[model samples]
Target: MSSKLRSIRAGHRSVISRLLKKFEDIRDDGDEPVNTEELTKIVNNLLKKQETLQKLNEDILENLDEGEVEAEIVDSDEYAYTLDGKITQIQKLILVNTSTLSTNAKDFRQL
Candidate 1:
């Protein structure tokens, strides 16, 4: 049982770490025209990992001694929400950049 708990904790950490790295990569590449296709792939991957993270959180709570189930649930839910927000921010950034690029292309062609 202890080993199971440790595995779940490790998995949780791995997923979160990967998610943060992906997010940082996008931010670090800022001001460059993003490859929408690649960005979509990253977002899709993030979503899947986020789901896995939530599941791991559930597994963690299951292994707990049941002293603060409600609080843990709230914390996990909040964490998921925050990740969702980050995903949305990335999506919006891509949309804005794509739109700007489209406009610039049109203006250049007209000149």
Candidate 2:
């Protein structure tokens, strides 16, 4: 895998770990006048991290090889529609393939 991909994955992991730790801390402090201000700060921090992660994911997708995967021009509504259509097509293909595998398994059992 590329260094960029590795870095992005690592960043995602770090954010998730931090979020989990924050939740654990809150849980451990159970029911004794929870500090609303501190909880708000934690939530805001996580939201910022999530926004950063979204931007990173968008950058990675935008920089992907255009030749290997047809790059969707997120700048246009038509391109967004095309992407949604492609995703639906892929979902249908997966469903069809799964059904075919099940049928094949049944045939094998009958042999």
Query: Candidate 1 at residue 37, lDDT?
Result: 72
Model 1 per-residue lDDT tens digits across residues 21-89:
776786688676566776677778778877787777877788777786787788778878887887898
Candidate 1 overall lDDT versus native: 0.72
Candidate 2 lowest-lDDT run of ten:
68-77
TM-score against truth, every candidate:
0.64, 0.46
Task: Name the regions of candidate 1 deviating beyond 4 angstroms.
Answer: 2-6, 100-111
lDDT of 2 by residue, 1-111 (tens): 335853875676576566547645754665654444555555556556555655665666666676633433343235335434533443443345345456536355544
Collision pairs in model 2: none
Highest lDDT model number: 1
